[model samples]
Target: MQAQRKMRIAHYGRKPVKIYGKTTQIDSSLMANTTQEEKRCSFITLNSDPLYVAYHDEEWGVLVHDDKMLFELLVLTSAKVGMDWTSILRKRHDFRAAFARFDTKIVANFTERQIASVATNCNLDLKKV
Candidate 1:
C-alpha cells in the first residue's frame, strides 16, 4: 500500500492554512506571480527567504554617500559578523535608537560608557569601523 502525504497547519495572520510537503507554508503577499528573473537579479537565488529578496531588490549595491546613511550602514555591517543579514535588518530600528540614529559625529564622540550601554542593551558584537 502507498503512504498518504502528511499535512501541517500554519497561520497567516489569523487564518489557518493547511500545509503539505516539506515546505508549504506560503505567504501569499510575497508571491507576486512573477517569473524568477522578474523577482530579482540572477545573483539572488534565496527566493524562499524574504529578507534576502528585500535586501537584493531594495538595498543591494545602492550608492550611499550621505554621512548619516553611511554611518548606519557601517554599524549594521559591523554587526553582520557571525549573524545573518536578516537579523541585522530586523534589528535596524533598535540599532538606530541605541546608536543615536547613526549620527556620525555623535557616534564618533560616543563615550565608552554610552558605547558599553548600547552594546549591553542591544547584545550586538560590533566591529570598530
Candidate 2:
C-alpha cells in the first residue's frame, strides 16, 4: 500500500475584517477596552451619534419585505439625494406624518394642493414634495 501524505493548513496571525465594504486586518488588542456595542459595530460607527450607530446596527443592511416599510425606505432614499443620511433619519417621524404613514394608495393620490399643504406644514422643500 502507498503511504498517504499529510496536508497542512496555514494559519494567518491576524484576523481579516470587512469594514465599510473593504477587507482589512484588525488587531485584537485594539478592541481590548471597547464595550460590546463598540466591538460589534463598524469602524465608522465607533464615534458616531447614537441614532446613527443604532441605524447601522439594526437596519443598514437588513432586508425589508413589507410594502409600507419598502415605501418608507424608497421615500427616505429619494429625500437623501442632496442631504445626509443623518438628517433624513432624524426627520423620519416628520416624513411619516407628512406622507400619510407611507401608505402607497394614500400618497399615490396626493393632489398638488395636498402636496403643497404637506410641504408647508412640515417645512419641507416645495420642489422635493
Candidate 3:
C-alpha cells in the first residue's frame, strides 16, 4: 500500500496554541486531518528511533509459518527476560549459535555439555529459557 503523507502538529501566523503554558503558533497550511488508519500506515509507529521504526514496519505483527523462523522468534522472545528487543535483535547471531542455529531437532538434542558451553560462551539467560 502507498504510504500516506507525513504530518506534524505545526502552527504559524495568527493561530497561537497554548502548549505547556507557552503560546505557540499553529501552522494551518501544514495541518493534516487524517483517519487513525492513515496515520498508522504513514509511519511504523510514534517512535522516532530508526531501528525501532524499521522493526515495526518490517516485522511487527507479521505471521510466521516457517519452523526455523518461529524457532528463532521463540528463542528471541525467551531471551528477553531482562533485556530489550533492540538488544535481542543485536544478539541474534549469538542466539543462533548458542541454540544450535535454532534447528528444532538439534536444539532439542543438546547435551548437558553443549548446554553448559552455550551458557558460558553466550549472553543468553538460561534461567528465562
RMSD per model, one decimal: 14.6, 12.3, 14.2
> What tens digits encode model 2's per-residue C-alpha lDDT throughout 7-99?
000111224656689986544444454444532433555468778767765676554569999999988887787788888899999999999
Q: Name the Cα RMSD for model 2.
A: 12.3
Off by over 4 Å in 2: 1-43, 121-129
Runs in model 3 lying further than 4 Å from the true structure: 1-49
Which of candidates 1 and 3 is the stronger one according to lDDT?
Answer: 3
lDDT (Cα) of model 3: 0.66
Please report the candidate that would top lDDT against the real structure: 2
Who is ahead in TM-score, 2 or 3? 2
TM-score of each: 0.61, 0.62, 0.60
Runs of candidate 1 with Cα error greater than 4 angstroms are 1-36, 42-47, 126-129
Clash number by candidate, in order:
0, 0, 6
Clashing pairs for model 2 are none
36-122 in candidate 1: lDDT tens per residue? 444455556745478777776666655555888888887888888788787888888899999888887788898999988898887
Q: CA lDDT of each candidate?
A: 0.65, 0.68, 0.66
Write down the lDDT that model 1 would get: 0.65
Pairs that collide, model 1:
none
Q: In candidate 2, what residue range of length 10 has the lowest lDDT sum?
A: 1-10
